[model samples]
Target: MDRLILADTERREIKALLNVSMDIDLNETKDFELSVHRSAWDDTYQYGGYIFKPGTEIGGRIGRLNTDTALETVKVCGLTWRGMLNRKVIEPPAGQDYRRISGELHEVMKELIEPEFEGLFLVSEADTGVTVKNHKFERYTDLLSGIIKMLKSVKYKLRITYQEESQRAGYVLVEAVPIIDYSSQIELSSDSGLDFQLNDIRNGYNHMIVAGKGELAERNVFHLYAWPDGSIRKTPYYTGIDERVYVYENTSTETEEVEEKAREEFAELMNRQEFTMNTSDLQMEVGIGDILGGRDYLTGVYMAKPVENIIYTTDAYGTMNVEYQLEGED
Candidate 1:
């Protein structure tokens, strides 16, 4: 079995953990769980101690530990949760036509690293060459939500990594990478040694009434409509046609800003397709944020969706398995 190392915050090594499994989602935080015999419990595995592999930066800190006397085992959970940022706020000046890792975005990252994030996070200088339009962070907005919204505006996802043997060792590197479309290169089918199942459930409101920050009479409000063709617009194309209305509340006071945020959220909820694929028999590495092309012969359906979530697990017998959950429309 592969070893999972427990390191201190200063990048010092501790002991290797036993029976560990890790899960990483492209759009969310990473999580891990490990268990050992009751006699093997160590006091050094305290909360906030980093849990990672020796060569790579893919890991989190210990969040919780439980001792089970009935089973004589000690279980630990490593949660790479960013919920702490929910209490923090960031306000960057609104700008337009900003390139990735430059100008206003660079200032935003610096602020996030210093007084905002308290120097706990560092961002990479890798430029994805994706330009953003009307990039704005509402005043007093939570840092976590603002970062997610900003990345989504440019079709990028956030990845936190660490440098093991560089000048920046022990420092976390936050990167904004574009969602790569690999549909033209890798095609998965029944003939390609991949077992898959698709579930397309269509039941959701297509219309949204966004209420922005204000009192009863002065409340800033806007309307957003989601088309079946995966486009969001302020103007509705048809009247009372599949028009199930849903109310969305926003913290922005500007009507236009509220409409933009509402449209983004509404589109995320409505423009998704779910599929489960087993990659045990495949010979390639399928990463998160990668758009994979899949075709099912029985249903005659084709999908070019992104890998939103993935789980890597190693059993006690030294066998490793990878499972992927692909989502989003073609």
Candidate 2:
């Protein structure tokens, strides 16, 4: 029954699970921090699950026993990987250790994140022509936590993709925008649905203003897309002229890139209306970054993109819940 495992190494299984839960997000950690629950009885001699002591080299597996294979592993400090919430000990640096780098997209990723990830591959969609300045992470911060925070602080439009390492590589990809390629559109109605509601359409917006310090101070853009064919609504209906301001600091984003991202912000803003639907309709194949289009008895017709898609499973069956936001059009 060993459907879940926390391993001492990628090849060897260590702790067979009692229960496990994980959350994957588009704008969140690619190397997810999984929350696992081990039954108190599992460690007893009669029960038979291995004990995971702190500081052991830890890897994991989650699949049907003897049927599905384990997932690719990442090297993690076992002590920090322990328990419901893995909080690392914050300490100061022993020496003046210096690490610095500058280059194209891949090289920059290699210098900043590859060491922590090991053998992982990063795919960047932007032109490598743009350069990154040398950055030295401050001392006393946990390396992984520091870099991830740095990624956010520096303000790069990045989303991590978790994939098993194949041929000396793992996946860490960056894109110009969130990937929303729906193979096909799906429809849901009051009776034909799991859950549906319109939330804060008044917060919907058609404009974005991006500002930063230094040379490129501000860039503003508007969101306008062609009304769907044979549609009655000509424009977005909001309480007022909803507009938003986004800022990136300590960043070297070029003027052109700033303008481009500002526009993307405008499009994702189309996601003000919320939609919740049964993943069973899509055979549980629907995932984040997918586009969903449907009509509501009260709200009418609309198109949306999946921002948060959650799945729950036990030994036999699984259910998926997807939360969708409006998809901004051209």
User: Please, what is the whole-model Cα lDDT of each candidate in the order they appear?
Assistant: 0.63, 0.37
Error of 2 at 1 (Å): 8.3
Residue-by-residue lDDT tens digits, candidate 2, 1-330: 223334332323444444343332222222223333323223221111122212211221222121112542221212111111113222333664544445654456554444443332244546645455665544444544544434443433334333433353223343323334452444655565445444435343433334533543253332333222312132443323343333323245544455444544555554355555444444434433455654666756454544343322232121223323333221
RMSD to native, candidate 2:
12.3
Question: What TM-score would each prediction reach against the true structure?
Answer: 0.72, 0.40
- Candidate maximizing lDDT: 1
What TM-score, to 2 decimals, does candidate 2 have? 0.40
Global fold similarity of model 1 (TM-score):
0.72
Tens-place lDDT per residue, model 1, 12-76, is: 66766655444433234456666666676668877777766543435666777877679866777
Best by TM-score: 1
State how far residue 46 of model 2 sits from its true place (Å): 22
